[model samples]
Target: MAPNNQTLGNNELGAWRIFSLFMLLIQKGPLPSAEIYAAIYSDLSTDSALRTFSRDRTVLKQLGFAITEVKTGKEKSFYLSDSNFFNSSYDLSPEDANQLLVICSAILTDATFVYQEELRNALSKIVGNFYSLESGKSDSQKLSASSQNKVFPVLYESLSSKQLVNITYTNSQDLVKQKHLGVLDFFVSQRLLYFVAQDFSSGTESASIKTFRVDRVLDAAILKNESFSIPEEFDSKDYKLLDFQLGLQADTLTAFVPKNILAAFEHFSQGQGDVELLSNGALWTVTYAHEDTALSWILAHGLIPRSPESLLAKWKGSLSEVANGC
Candidate 1:
């Protein structure tokens, strides 16, 4: 049993050696089986070496190496098909490259972000690969400065440390109010950053979740003495901003969307619709809470509502009003 175990270990070591040798040889150029066997295992007999090489070739293919066999006259040689396999390079389109540069420039120019230095260093490495140092620096300097959100850093810190925060916020109606909140998460929407928090002003046990626009916050201070735990069942996705209207009841609405504006409709709906393809267009069924948003989307995209007679009539009436105005 000891001798058998030693033999198995030796076999495994030999298998790894063959695999490495095969990879090295194929990367340099195609080599015939005889040449590969001779180069890898000089001590073994040609027949034995050839058998091992053949087995290892199968293993290499299974491991996702793009090794292809080519027949030059009578001899077969194996070579890697993908030339850039060992040193892969990203091939971004011109537009995508420009966009990436723009975003990196924005991040580098913005001094308010907490991770500014780290982010700049990382982005410099990536952008440096494509653009010259002088060009990258020039672009960064030319980029527009970010709109300052004074409370953003404070909210970020509170969210990270699981601490309570007291904020003085101005509502849309220009009324100022102060509240204590338990931070849950943060997200960006429509170029504005918002925080999802639990309202502690209503008391702890019956606290309700709410979203606060960071830009509207007049002042924010972290409460170091108090900390809060996030609910085990809470998911950030469930608290994302939906549309302009809040707390409105959602109704299932169906529309026949023309092919030309289908993409626009999908973008407005945020991919929340069931779609069926037609020869000329697509039929979409969506659940929307905001009537004004839905109405504007329908008018803009020339969408035809298919169900809920009341909605269809409303759309027609709106179109009629527009027609009269024209």
Candidate 2:
């Protein structure tokens, strides 16, 4: 055997076999331990192996295997108990697999974060394993699309080490803005990475840090500029994604969503805000953070404003003006 594969005692062999069987049980869902042992180690019949098998059973139970004891006073046995293990399929779903592929594509194309190469390799390994399983499947049925996996693993390491980065970045408005941006901190929520960028231009009084979505980044390069410490005042723990107000300038926007729109209140009151249900039963009083994305989303629904002819007429006129402009 190779150096990696040393001679195994009967007990070690039993433990290894049991571990493999446990993974199969998780994939196949809810099997009595006895059934699992029989399925994987039916050929093994030795005293030491049986003793090792008993110990492995206890170890597996402690490792969150959802194993529970089943007893009817006279008979007792252990069985797999978790129901969630059956969810999301033994393999990745078509939709979720596709979503990961898209994310990989975006990461490849994005030029912001400096950790793409390393993370992309890791992500690709996961994706490659998935595709390798579908060897005989048709090309159309497989995830064969190519993306660059545009993450800057090198730049990411620099940020992680508290080193400074220099890059020309455009502001949110899509202008040709260039400046050295210091990466203060990095955090992720809901699978989106946020880079806290601080302006590092001279002649500017002070630097102000702002969050940028990693996916939208154009490019990043590590600068030889002096390194800076992240401010203690900045606490990402208290930060919430919806708290940042972007776009539309409105204290409140009154709109109507059809009853069929699922979880309208949950969608509207994402951040810290109050949503009041109007008395008329048709409209919802939504007090939001006056964000552009939220407003555009609400406007995109093309909800008709309610009652009081003047308000309705104003909205109609606004719509007509926007339509003519478009």
Candidate 3:
């Protein structure tokens, strides 16, 4: 009825007329039939244009446009009230909702969860729709999903209950050892859960919480009798130097990385530093640690970190040359 090409002189109402009327109401908000047709119907000058558009509304209703009236007035107006995009029952802020979507996307890269595709698709659709509402904002986060099923509860409950656990763990130096450890805290770092522990090799002794990879733990048994105190003075975040224990005599050293790599570097170092950007664009500095974990971390990140060339690299390079048959 509203001057659309498909509606002029047609005995039966066309689908395009109904679709255009619905889109007009959605985009421009509610309007009465006279205003709606005057805005869109080219046949408004014709004799039967009003009756034709009224029939079009009936066609739209049959096609599922749950259009509702705004008020009981001389001029009746209508709008879409049942649209999925306009619904407000979903509970999530635009940003966190999108973040949850990204988490779903990144997890799909893992082959371990392929069998649960139906559940994954449902979550994906929900999150994808949620993300669509917050499109064009940059809040990107990348994380790898664990191959194992839920492990946080085991670690969290063990630490909260003050239980001692026996586990086979590999330290930063790749040295695997089996020992009884008292749980101090459970935390997620870089998307992996770590259990902070104290060595229970001897008597009831208080020690700094040394982090153990939760995934690598071969076995966990709760020892009900043992208990220990985490020093009030000890700060979990700043004690990287003071708290480290590799079963080796504690000592100090310096490590550095380029400023761009400083974020990964901070994971292994204390807060203090006077690092200088060298002419070659690498960082040079000092740190203190009892074990080679700090160095190994840098190497693992492929950041090419080095101790003083005179102390560590000269011998390392010599070994490299000999291994190369030079």
Strongest candidate by TM-score: 1
Instruction: Summarize candidate 3's per-residue lDDT along 1-326 as a digit string, tens digits.
Output: 42232323342235334545655776655777567767557656645667766677665565445567676477777767666333344355555443443333333323333322443434434443333223332333211122112233334334545566666654556577777776665433333334566877555465545666555554445667765556677565542323223235444344446667666555544453456666544454545343455444444554554554443664466458879999
Cα error, residue 278 of model 1, in Å, equals 10
The candidate scoring highest on lDDT is 1
Tens digit of per-residue lDDT, candidate 1, span 1-326: 11123433564455435444644654477877567666666667878777766777666555445567799778888777675343233443444444444443333323333344444344334333333222223453321223222354566556656788998876657698998988777544433345688888766576788877655666778998888888887876666654432334567778898999877766765555589989899998877677767766666768898877778888889889988995
Give the alpha carbon lDDT tens digit for every residue of 1-326 in model 2.
11134565655454445545555554554455456557665665656446756677666554434455566355455556765323333455445444554444433433443344555455444443444333333554322323212333423534554555655444546564555666654444333445566666663636776676444444555666466676778764333344324323345555665655525545543433334544433465543444444445555654555533445566677688889995
User: Positional deviation of 79 in candidate 1, in angstroms?
Assistant: 41
| Candidate 3, run of 10 with poorest lDDT | 141-150
Off by over 4 Å in 2: 1-117, 120-151, 184-194, 202-205, 237-240, 247-293, 296-326
Model 3: pairs clashing at backbone N, Cα or C within 3 Å: 2-41, 3-41, 3-42, 253-287, 254-286, 254-287
Q: What does candidate 1 score on TM?
A: 0.46
- Candidate 2: residue 6 lDDT (0-100): 59
Candidate 3 has a TM-score of 0.35
TM-score against truth, every candidate: 0.46, 0.39, 0.35
Local distance difference test, candidate 1: 0.61
- lDDT: worst 10-residue window of model 2: 142-151
Query: Candidate 3 lDDT (Cα, whole model)?
Result: 0.50
- TM-score rank order: 1, 2, 3
